[model samples]
Target: MSDVASQAGRVIDAGAIRAGTSNAPGKTAWRIAWGVALVVFVMLWLFGKPVAGWAFDVPRAWRIPVQRWISDAMKWLVDDASFGLFSFTDLTRFLATLVEVPYRLVLGLLSTGIMDGRGSSAQEILPPLSWLAVIGVVALMGYFAGGRRLAFIVGGCFVFLAVFGQWDSAMVTLASILIAVPIGVVGGLLLGLAAFRWRAVDIALRPLLDLMQTVPVFAYLVPILFLFGFGPTSAIVATIVYALPPMTRISLLALKGVPDEVHELGRMTGCSRRQMTWRILVPSAMPGLMIGVNQVIMLSLNMVIIASMIGAGGLGFDVLAALRRLDIGAGFEAGLAIVALAIALDRLSQAFAARRPEHVAAGAGEKNLLARHPYTVAGLALIVAGGLAGLVAAPLQSYPEALQISTGTLGSDLVSWININFFDQLEAVKNALLLNVLIPVKRFLTSLPWVGVTGLLALAGLRLGGWRLALLVSVLSCLIAFTGQWEKAMITVYLCGISVVIASLVGIPIGVLAAGRERLWKFVELVVDTLQTLPSFVYLMPAVMLFRVGDFTAMIAVVAYAVAPAIRYTAYGLRRVDPQLVEAGVVAGATPWQLLTKIRLKLALPEILLGVNQTVMLALSMLVITALVGTRDLGQEVYIALTKADTGRGLVAGLSVAFIAIIADRLISAGANRIRARLGLPEGEGGHR
Candidate 1:
């Protein structure tokens, strides 16, 4: 009887242990949080009509008058504000003039001849650099930067620009980028340095940096347009604003990452604070800082198209014109020019960033400059020879129109053929997607009570992170609601959400396949890299050509533009999975499918989630550009405000979009972190296995 009782007690103890292990405290908490949220959501859906009326949408009476207040403040600034001795307009005009000086100089050097007078009386003093000379110099720089391969790529891109009749516009765009990039880099570096030196400044700058980056590019133009008035100056200012944040953030990080040993070395040398920062810290951090420069360059080029709307005329203006007229051929040609320029500059900058200086023996610096830098001398010689030859040959001075090739006719013919033969099929596919997948999802999302959605998202934040994340999520969500942008915000979410889902669906499988095959991954890597280099505006052209302007067209563009990150992140994550774990599974006699499903996929889940988070960010950014193709969401609001020069309205709408992006970014990131923790991974090991 005693033995039987002891056996029963042991069985009960075993059951208790099993229960504790299966339902750990954290797991139980998660279950309770989710269960409560589900019940609340159901109850809200069923019997909360009275609350839903107010909660579904914030009434105008309850909405904040933020727009009016901002508008009034802006008006006051423009009309009456002064900086002691100078009025606001005075300062703005002076700043504009400062920007215009370098811009005009670069524009003259590249695209237009220097002018001696104003208007019709203006006389050309010197012709712009010969197209051949420009190309040769750029090619030489490429050769010096990377080698023959990079030289060919850079030279080929420029030659294409000239041969394809996009030389003038491309140069104009290039000029803007050249000017804006330097300013952005300098200003960002200074700001970063300041922030790094002062902890309080770093803290203060964090949220501002977040807003500067997350806010749609279009939102930038409104205030600049209002303040500086419209022209290339305003556009340059906007580009600077758009490109500055990344450089600043990168610089700060780079400075922080400099080794303590470097600091100690500087101090041992009796270096002053300034000398230590410039000579020791900055040089030690140069590689990371160059990454910031690369970002600034890329971002400056990306802004070219959007900045054109405010009068930074170049390839951007050409593309915008073609887009507006629905001229597919012209748009494609101009878009390709932008791509060519982007790829060339991207490669050149990346090469320079990765380049290391060769060490010189003692007194090697005494060599003549011409002998020491053969590439530079050769580049200069080519430019001089080309310039002198241009004095005799008109063709050398400017590319001949007759020699230029255009694909406009070919593009038109292709479009015509497709429309004539396959229009019905295309329409069928588009309609089926809209009717079956898009419209229903949009309607359901739009129908959800704003309060309920906010609560659910907040609850998600709570489960994934903690109360702090939950509070942040709810506040940002409420900001949209109280701003009277709840409906439009929901529409934006619907579009972005659907686009993300589609991108993930398409990108993940390809990424998975690519991960296991080296050749396939190389091909996928090349494709994604090329796709990423194209500006956001370029994606719209193909989408519009295939599916005219509407929500469908917008979704297609957003998906194409946003899908690259998903593929990249997934492949990267899968590649980072522990090979030993795979070996162990194989040793256990697991089949290929079982190894992938139960081992690789499980371990890579956190990384895949991060990829999705990146996908969400890219989707939101592209969705703003989709506004050009007639989607009515927050992007449209910003667009309308831009047209009207309504600073407050544009800012309000743009901030709402930023809020949405932030909430999504934070929540998703937290979820990924949670998964990492559960997997027993160390924090901040996102880049490692």
Candidate 2:
């Protein structure tokens, strides 16, 4: 108890809390600050821009000359860095070779015959595992993890893969993920364990993880490409970087949340560090570790499309090819394969996370075979059935030629149908929104004098979180302006801002609807999980079909990717609202509407605000990818810089995006804190936020 209390004091800044009666004074101060900000904004709106005339933009002579330096530095590090004793280039090559061994091994098993040429070549690496054999194995494993229903769902996914002739592509993708998930999990656990053992390490890692999560994945892809020289190695390494953060975060949280009593008991028993961790700490943290693995799987799969760009051959490549050719049928088929893989893996991991260990003693087992080895019996039964099916007919043995189906034409046909029947209507709606809403918002944000905008943001930050936040937002805003990327940065911000509003407007209401109903929540979660696990690139396909190639299409893609977290966080917050307060409202003769408004939503505000914060972060992360669909934002600059291998330009644009995310994150976090303070809630009542 004493240890926990001490730790809590250090974790939360008491001076900043203000979660008490003094909140009245804090609220009054905030109101006055807002009033002043409003007046200043009005004055700027009337006369400032006319006088300045885009003078807020840093002159070319004054703009910082950092890009060239960055580019030169990166080139030296990648192509020439050495200590006279050890060459960085050689070391990276060695690592790539090490990664490629397992890559070949997994790819060989799933897509090629093993040792076809005794390691001389990778041609003919495809295996001959019949469809029935694979299906039986999956169904049996699914049954073991969840139950009959899950088995059916998983089995159906395979059937879809085979029927759609996506089996090869799907399995190749799964093979890489099979390798990446373990690497991420192990790496994350080690880092997390180190953080847990040392307080300084934890503090240092916190900001690193935050920045890493915000850095656009596209920003780092080119550097990784240079290091690993493209292929499965580069793709896998990039994925490791992308997926590792969540594991470390989840593991750290689990370590911190470990019961204090467990530690005390370990001490009393004179348990060694290794023993305690292996036998107690890890066992106790199984649920969190399992969740981390689950996330790793989903993230690895999500990287499929990005990985494909670098020659990590899989369904992602097929999807990209289809998209390039505007072959919706082909793209949709490959995308479905990805979706199937994600859902199956997510469900299996989820069920396994909830699995309970059997408690029976070795000598106390039941005599009946079924009771003694239910899972084993089921596995054996599946093998026997698969054998019989394989012998009965070739069609039943593998994805038979006769049974294979293609959606090659369906995509084009659907596109044609939409273009003919719905394109005109959607174009009208799209044009109206572009002309009246999106374009105006972009212009307004871009026209704001950078100097004035900086002041307003700093003022807001000061009102919310004092000097630290003021300095943070001010520095970030100035960096963008001084880099001469202010115009592009504003457009990025405009996209994120609009996306957040739309996401909140749609997500929060759906969340509210699902919060009170278990079945509905489950259904919502299923759809959300599917969307959340897809690569950001996948979203552009549908958006392009609906809105065509433009900034508006990119905005739609951003919203699609960012909205899932909003819905999830809102529902979670509403559900976590104090039941006792709800009961009190009911006892006070409150109606359902009154109960929700006065009790539930009132207390859920902080969580909703945090959700909005996450939505903004996600929107920012998608900017670079959305540029693929055509958008003149910072992402476009990053994309162009990367393609041209201009390290300085890419890194600058990337950092600008990161800066936006951080400012938005901190500001929203401050708003959440203020809300919590006003409501007199503890700084830590937020559950799983």
Candidate 3:
């Protein structure tokens, strides 16, 4: 009897301990914090005007003079600052010249003939590669890298460029890519190597990389313009800056992911640190490093278009000119040329990244160069023969104007006809979306008291993460208010928020369907890949044509550009759900719908949230481009600053946008991590976690 009593006592104590653990003090504190935040928000909303004007917006007197301070600092750097041996201007000029040398050489080899002397006295000493030769070489590369199918696709794209009369412009764009990608890849590799080797370096670089990637490309141009002066060199420098982060990040990850056995083998072999890294680690990480190379190529292409604003010039310049003139037909053609270039390059690079070494039979290395490298020999022969042919045949040198096609007039007429026939329908749809959805959301967000919103977000951060995250969120949020950009920031939030919601609604359903159907997933994957390959600018043309310039048009563009990630992430998450869960549900008599809703979705919530987080980031990035069409948000502020050459204004606005992204990223990521923890899943799969 005494023994039984003691056992009961022990059981009660264990139950009490479990109860105490479940009802921890930290959870209670968070609940209290949230309750207080909610009450504060309600009070602010009810008595917003009566409480204080400062609650709604920061007063002009109270606003920080960050813009002025930044402007002054920039002026000092440009006008007075110097390294002991060289003035700032002198340093910039030297860097510019250094970038220019390779750029000029590549441009001459691809687009313009190598010239001697100045202006009217200049003579073409050697002709640029024939368009036909360039096409053949690229197709051969495609064949060698991937297969015949890839060869046809890439070859077709290049042929389209020549036949559409975009050869020279396309070549120029290609030249910029060729120059920028290598520099970015090499520089990023070195940085990534350093970070991987040193814990201190990695810790220091984390925030910088985050900032570099999150900051808008437009913001980069402002500083580069100020320091390097405006030209292709400056543009190339900006492109390199924009494209470097992904490579750096990927290289570090790849290096760290190298197998433990490989590391052990290198050490056991008594290899030096340099030899281990270069001969063993790097070779093993080649696949991932190649992925970094692919990213560098794609990002360089994307930035080169934006870089055109500062005089990079290419298909990008053509598109920008056409947009400025509202020549939709010309813009569409140039945009299409860019798409072709992007697709070809993307495919070629991806194929190269995925390629593996073939097995060599005995004595294979003894073969002649022609036998060992048939593709290389063939490419060289094509180049020499085509160049020689160009000297004799004009058609071989450059595509003839008579053979080139111009669909600009037809495209313009088609658009005009559509507007004439369907104006009422288009207007009704646009007005419906504007009246019922966009405007109301925009008003609600813009009308919120800044103090209340900031507090609520801080509370959310605290609940989701901890005090450190809460403090970070609050500081970044208040910086926007302090800089007197509260309203513009709200406007940005409104546009981005609505776009993300809509994208999620549309994309999630499609993703769910695609996840269940293999054929549908494959088709969706292809479309998504193509859409992602196109530059952000391409999406705007179609939106502008349909809706014209307004918040509605901008919203449409943002949704289209941002939807890919939503679909991609949703499908990915759903597919990754464990099969055992689904089988168990089936065994328990759950229907397909029930299994998906109750088991699969429950397990996939964290991943879906991550998708939404990515969707938000992409939407924000696209919104900046939508500024070209009209939208009175932070993006417009950056655009205006760009036009005015106001370094301080651009940087400040850019930072405000960056802060918004950072806030969204952190809050959503923290929430996801919490969900993962509750589900007993591992963390660190997304965001800061």
Candidate 4:
């Protein structure tokens, strides 16, 4: 006995052993408390009692008075007599009047009333200048930023747009995008900077960013349309909401990423905090911030189509109308136009961000005219050429007609073929999947008593993290139940659940396969980038056509959208597994499968869990868009509320979805962290995990 005691003592110090065990009692008590609280909360909610007393009373007591004050402030701001408060409608009207001036000028020059006038009758209203003139402008902008290759690529985009017969709608789309993107970028920058500056502000603002990013774009349209009354302003507002989060996140990330050495240098150089932040930190962060701007532009252009659902006319409206009328050619034409715009904007931003300071030749400043600044001179020359071409083309009626190309009956014909050849088979498959798979799963989730699910979730949270995470998840779940949208929320959760499962099944293997080699991993990463960059709505049409407006379609779309992060983090985790450990396994004569499963895969599990977290997030993000297929969930509620302009209903439903996402996000994050800790993964070593 003495010998055994001595050996045990040598193995681990008594104090250290006791200290390690000390966490158990506290954790047990916390878990007990979490269980009791969740039980009471779920009881109150499921029994149809006033869960509101606990859930909303605190917020209402604080929020109502504050909201009233904001309303009053807004009223005063708009109604100030000296500021033409009585004439508030003029704000919109004045802007409209300004737009009309340009509208008239362009119309007069082209002799086409279609520039501003609305008519159902089709008319060929091609631009006055040749396509070459527009190409020149694109090439000039590209040349200014980079070199000849970029110039040709950029110019080729415009040439493609024109040749495809998308010139007018494309320009209109461009005009709307140019106005919307700058607003989103500036707003996001300010908000992000403010969040970084103040802890309380950041705390308050974080939820808004979360909501803005996760809630379906459909949910936002109602509030914006109500405020702006559905036009360019409404479209711009929705675009801003959709695009701002990335910019804010990027801005915050970039600022936080500024090096300590750079900060020290700034301090030693006698710079004030403000000066240092502006001149040193901001400039250093510019590359990332520029990337954010690029993202904002891309997202804004993407939103243009969704925004059109609220009457914000552009290429989006054209596409939607064409789709509704089953005009496949027209739809594809508009889609191609949107794609062109996306590519052009993406390339332009990338090139501009990459531009560096260049050396000037001796006495080059004296060489003016076309020699000093080639791009500027070239741009001027193109604009002049365009004007002259317009004048020359005005007399020939056949010129404009020849320039205007159409898909004619081609798109409709193709769609008809698809509907006849593929639609029935797709429909049958979709029905089988929905009835056999999705229905059973959704029914099972709905069959669970709210208390049981709540208890399990809280328990899972407690096991994964400590009491804090458990409480957060319990409260979040409880809120969704108390909001009187529990069933709908469950349906949404069910859809998300299936999506995550599907994502994991597909993503993990791909990740493992890709992680085997550096080049293969890079190629997979490129695929992920493409998936994320492509618009969610672009996925929607094919899904709708295949699955035909049901839960099945929504689930499929969610899977496609959410799988990117899973593949990304999984590959990252597996690749990051210790090489030495794998070598050791190899030396032990472990086969490739055994080595991977036992060593690398085990280490990669935590990262794989992180991928699950992202899958949840992406699934939630897809909810609003997926609701277009008419699923009976919180997303549907949001969409309906938007159509009717019901702010309270929309906010409530939107928040419910957001709360659920937050709960899943927190729980999964906690669980992943715990797993990572156990796996001995180094701190801050994993990306998403």
Candidate with maximal TM-score: 1
C-alpha positional error of residue 238 in candidate 2 after TM-score superposition, expressed in Å: 0.8
lDDT of each: 0.87, 0.82, 0.87, 0.73
lDDT (tens digit, per residue) of candidate 4 on 491-585: 98899898899888998889989988889988999889777766566566656655568888888888998899889888888887766666666
- Per-residue lDDT tens digits of candidate 2, residues 306-346? 78887788898998897787677778778878888888888
lDDT of 3 by residue, 1-689 (tens): 44433322322233432235656786688678778878878888778767587989899999999999988998999999999999988988998888899988889999998989769999989899999899999999999999999999999999999999999999999999998999999999999999999999999999888888888888888878888878899999999999999999999999999999999999999999999989999999999999999889888888867999999999999888877766777787888888899889989999998999788889989999998989889999999999999999999999999999988667667878888899999999999989999899888888888888998888788778989898999999899999999999999999999999999998888888999899999999998876776677877876787789999999999999889888888888889876765665666677777777766776677888988998998898999889999999999999998998899999999999999999999999888887776555689563431
- In candidate 3, position 56 carries an lDDT of 90
By summed lDDT, the worst window of 10 consecutive residues in model 3 runs over: 10-19
Off-target runs (Cα >4 Å) in candidate 1 are 1-23, 359-361, 364-366, 687-689
**TM-scores, in order shown?**
0.94, 0.87, 0.92, 0.79
Candidate 2 residue pairs that clash: 111-125, 111-126, 112-125, 112-126, 113-125, 113-126, 329-411
Q: Candidate 2 regions off by >4 Å?
A: 1-32, 41-55, 118-128, 357-398, 517-523, 578-583, 586-593, 687-689
Best first by lDDT, ranked: 1, 3, 2, 4
Residue 83 CA displacement from its true place in model 2, Å: 4.1
Q: Note the clash tally of each candidate.
A: 0, 7, 1, 1
